[model samples]
Target chain A: MLATAAAAIALIFLQQAPAEDIDWDAEFGVEERERDPATGEFPVDPYEKSNANAGAEPFANGRLAAAFGGREGIRRIAERTVELSEADPRIAEIFVAHDTVRLKRTLSEQFCYLLGAGCDYTGRDMRATHDGLGIRTADLNALVENLQQAMREAGVPFAAQNRLLSKLAPMSGDVVER
Target chain B: MRTPCVATGLMLAILSAQPAHADDLEWFEGGKLVLTNGVTTIEGTSGGGIATWATIAGLEMDNGVGVSGHATIIELPDYGWQSHGVAVGIANRVELSYARQNFDTRDVGTALGLGEGYVLNQDIFAAKLRLLGDVVYGDPLLPQVSLGVEYKRSLDGDVAAAVGAARAEGLDYTLSATKLFLSRSVLVNATARLTEANQNGLLGFGSAAGAGHSLQFEGSLGYQLSRRAVIGAEVRTKPDNLGLGEDDWFDLFAAYAVTDNITVTAAYVDLGSIATFEDQRGAFLSAQVAF
Candidate 1:
């Protein structure tokens, strides 16, 4: 009887185990593509899905784009983000010497591109852009705070904000150096 | 007069240096990090009241340091127990803790002819090293694992011996694993301990009926209600070597983080029997401050 009870308990534990091998990016709504069976690598750029609808009509089918009020709403979020970053003491130093207008425009373009707005991102890749600045995890966290505040101030729904954040979170690998 | 003046100068220098050292440390914001990282346990470990988890205390972002202090009170029907402790986490990788416990025998003492309010005091010093995996982010198949050892010393050796205890103190070694399932908003922990502590060392180590070390198990499950609160239940099995009809312990608790530096926990505990007193049910409350 004791052995049977132990086996039942072990079976229950096994049943509750998570399917850990699933790709998180795909699970979070990233577009799926074919992968090489040998190398388990995709041939196309992984980030292309985020930019698939770029240069297309805003909110045509994307839930995140519609929730953020489309292209114009994304632009507003970018502007507010830049403003907040400049005012945030923890990260203000990083923006002190940046060109405010250029930065805002790049940010607007990036948001629009990510949201499938009819715009193309012309900025450099995340790693190259952040290289040599010695950015740490704390600095990244501070920037995320500013971004969240900016999104909230711009009336972006919380769900939409989280969706966008999920897409951007993977960039930390390329951005943070310290 | 000259010696007094020099002593005052030295004291002033030490006082001034303390704040300078504190200022050099970084403080992370509250709520920005994941839940379940900073709460303090009754044993001064970074876990729930009755269970010692594999995580460390404080909100150290990456390579930062954090320190915390906790005080817990458990009011049983026939006894009262209080514990005061402090723990330090170094870069979220290692933890060092110290706790002092006082168990009030109250009416039970009178029944045993040891006075009406006899108190049993013990000191515990512990260190835990995180071995592998991250409870929150690492591979879901593998939970965070840690190894720890707690050295306990009873202050009342004579009284402990009177109760047929073999030794006044002993060491408890533990292997703990903790996992957080973010999708389900639940956390689970399991720990295996090798010890011979009777009534958590308040009654000393081992007894006439049962001597030497025995293996025990502890399990805990918690559900996150919000960014700052978690409701959990814990079960800790004890060795029955004392011939005192010792029973396993259970508790249901809620731990809330009011801020990055302050947390409060309350629980309903059923300690079963202590010193042969039956049905020891009571309330448990703990407050912790960390940074």
Candidate 2:
């Protein structure tokens, strides 16, 4: 009888444990996966769905590349964006020391790579690239406006433009220093 | 009274001084999410239909001011309520609001010896100041906090006296906290209020049964479906000092932003009992325009 009462008391305490103890990911249809016990990090898998580009539509890259009118078309968008940035007073200050032609090429490569056009991005990461520039919200908005205008002039569809912008939006955390 | 009007005049003066482009300063920027900032509460504070939250009224960028106006109508089986108000947010830090509410007694007035179609009018003047944290970008462990006060005055002192009310006016002081989990697209708000208002000051301040204030709570949870739409639920606990057996209030609502300047909200509300009327289920509709 004593042992049975002790087991019953233990059962009640287990039931009263905090709800956060439950593994929510496992309950929410995530596949069974292994994680390092020490770091609680999943093993790196290049082709995993939970990769760096998880939330983006799988076919967005090809669709965006096609929408931007192939390789030459992508290059036109980059050139126009760079030209506008250099002319726009709000953003021109940031590009005063940039090598225009190389910057344009790097932007084109980055855009193509993001759209899954099979091009390698040789530019620095967004955080490192924008570091110490003292970019403000207004400056970011100006840059986005210029990019949108360039895309419009390049004849990219609005939907495709937004698809790319959505992916780029998260980078604001890293790109804006203040 | 003079202060609110003066503030409004000052805001108008500043608005007229700015260029047309400056009006567009309320656009979402720097990781601010659209519609995540709740619309004007019934009392004209920034929040959902019934509860007040800690957020400012507009989509204004940090250090910018935003102003908003709202009109709300609620249709219950036994009563009708309408409210109109204006609110100003300064630097996303402080909020000043004023709302005038009219509660149509309908048949309830006639049954109580008053003429049919009688209306009870009330004025609510409110002010809220953000004290700590940001709802979206501040520390994840801590929510945005604000302290506010609503001074409500009932226009019908005779009616309130007839109903055994102790006073025709009262003050509600509240402390609210709001948090938004951006990645999950969820927002939660909780508010604690100390008040003596009976039926939110529409019936009156305190009742003959009790003149002391009671602590109450209001909470809300919302899920963002898109950049422009949010669906949410709110529950508000009320003080029962009136002896009229008032129950809690509950609502489920959806708000959609037509643009940065305009928003519309519709909800199903259960206000329980009021002044002997039971089961006050109804519909609520509100439209707001903000700069």
- State each candidate's chain A TM-score: 0.64, 0.65
Best-matching candidate per lDDT: 2
Per-residue lDDT of candidate 2, residues B92-211 (tens digit) = 778899999999989988997778989999999999999987675534547889999999999988888888788999999999999866545678999999998889888788877667
Model 2, runs deviating above 4 Å:
A1-178, B1-33
DockQ of each: 0.04, 0.02
**What is the lDDT for A66 in model 1?**
70
lDDT tens readout by residue for model 1, B1-291: 678679988999999899658435454442225454646666677877888898877666555777778899999999999999988777667889999999999988899888999998999999999898767543455787999999999998888788888899999998999986654667899999999998888888998666879999989999877556789999999987678888999999998878757889999999998888999999999999877
TM-score (C-alpha) between model 2 and the true structure: 0.64
User: How far does residue A161 in candidate 1 sit from its true spot (Å)?
Assistant: 9.0
Candidate 1 segments whose C-alpha is farther than 4 A from its true place:
A1-86, A94-135, A139-176, B1-36, B138-142, B208-210
State residue B33's C-alpha deviation in candidate 2, in Å: 4.2
lDDT of each: 0.77, 0.79
- Stretch of 10 with least lDDT, candidate 1 chain B: B23-32
Cα-based RMSD of the predictions, in order?
20.4, 22.6
Q: What CAPRI class is candidate 1?
A: incorrect
